[model samples]
Target: MPRYRKRKQATQRKNLIGSLLIFAVLGLVAFLAFFRYELQNKQLAYDTETLCPSNITSPKYVALVFDKSDAYNKIQQQFLRRFFDDFKANLLPGTRISIYVIDAHNNKEIAPDFVVCVPRTGDDANALYENPKLIRQRWHERFEQPLDLAINGFMQPAQADFSPIMEVFQTISLSAFPLGSETVPKQIILISDMLQHTPEWSHYRGQMDFSKLQKTLYYQRINTDLQQAEVNILYVRREGMEKLQNKRHAFFWSDFIQSIGGRVTLIEKIDG
Candidate 1:
């Protein structure tokens, strides 16, 4: 009887030890899971659609100014497609992209075709916690589709009697990148023939001159503060207009952009 009692007590001790070990392992796992959840929530605590904080304001701005004063040919269109693809790929998740069109007839009116902040995609999601497939689907339905539609509509041929590129710039600087706002990275993708034609001043009349433009009242009227925005000129080259769209013409525009507190990053000529 004594021996049997001793064996029973030993078995009970063993069971208690096993239970304690199991509880300890579970406690460790719970701690790790809670830590991971806290860290992820802090970093990715953003709205799914805007990919921005609760304020819904983006930290970066990208403005695309399309000059539809002249129609783009098939080859130029192809080039534009490739350029847009590259631009989309490099964009950060929360960047705001606004599309503006320089009207063909009405140089005074500058209207935005599309404006939206990029959403977080599948690639930006964590597979361990979030469903990437659902995020991607939502992004495509809400963000990508509308952007594609707006761009396609602008790609169609539209000819204008005048191209008021300077006025459009001034308006964009005032409306899009308003003064006193928090300084953020700003970029302008200008797709045009780099030709400035209006009732006041026309580049087609004679040789391109930067000094002559600075002396005019129109220059003062169009004086814009671009807020140190980076300008990428997608210069459209027209057939049989070499003299107007040559290297000197490009330099003239470059000087003008610099005077307005904008840095010219690229001046790529898009030709058929």
Candidate 2:
């Protein structure tokens, strides 16, 4: 009887130990699974924030201003291709993108030549469940497909025309893009030669007297506060410009842009 009792106690201890080991293994697996999910979710949140941070009320806005006067060079084409190709990845749901042309004569009356407002389809919530392929497909169908068509049609080569860049700038700054919700951010991407070719202050003719121009009708009439917006200039260099001339051009634009509400974040020159 004593031997039997000892054997029974030993078997109970072994069983208990085995049960504890099984539970420990299960717990570790559950912890690992939860950790992975949390990590992935954190990554998704960060990506979304970097692309377009917004709240329940406000949405992000981006404006692509193409200078119709600037010749569409090889470098410009390459840059535009890359920009548009990567555009979908950098946008959040409900972000608006407007495409406009900077021409002296045409598109002057109209503020933004083309406007596209992205809709929220709640696809972002499925980031964990959906594969990359399906997500890409959804992006194309919703935003990228239409944008591709618009950009292709707009980028066709045209004669170098007069650039009413100041007028375009004023229009964009004053009323074209309104201050939507205080939380929303604004962006303007200017693809141009950074040369002002208007009658009031023509960079092609001579040096611009910014102080004198500020007191004139053209400047006073369109005083806009674009401090809330970020301006990025993808500078297209014109042929036959000396080093000094290019510096002057940059100075005129950078100063004028700063004088107004626009913040010049980047002034990158595109080369072939």
Q: Pick the candidate with the highest TM-score.
A: 1
- Model 2 TM-score relative to the real fold: 0.69
Looking at model 1, residue 131 earns an lDDT score of 82
Query: How would you encode candidate 2's per-residue C-alpha lDDT over 95-114 as one tens digit per residue?
Result: 76777887657444656676
Runs off by more than 4 Å, candidate 1:
1-57, 105-111, 178-182
The lowest-lDDT stretch of 10 consecutive residues in candidate 1 is 47-56
Q: After superposition, how far is residue 73 of candidate 1 from its true place, in Å?
A: 0.5
Give one digit per residue, the lDDT tens place, for model 1 in 1-272.
99999999999999999999999999989988997986566465565644445554567888898888888889998899888877777788778887888765554445456677777678866665678898899678877787777777787877778888878778778767745544889999998887888888888986478889899898898998988899999989888888788888888988999998889999998867
Off by over 4 Å in 2: 1-58, 119-123, 127-136, 174-176, 243-245
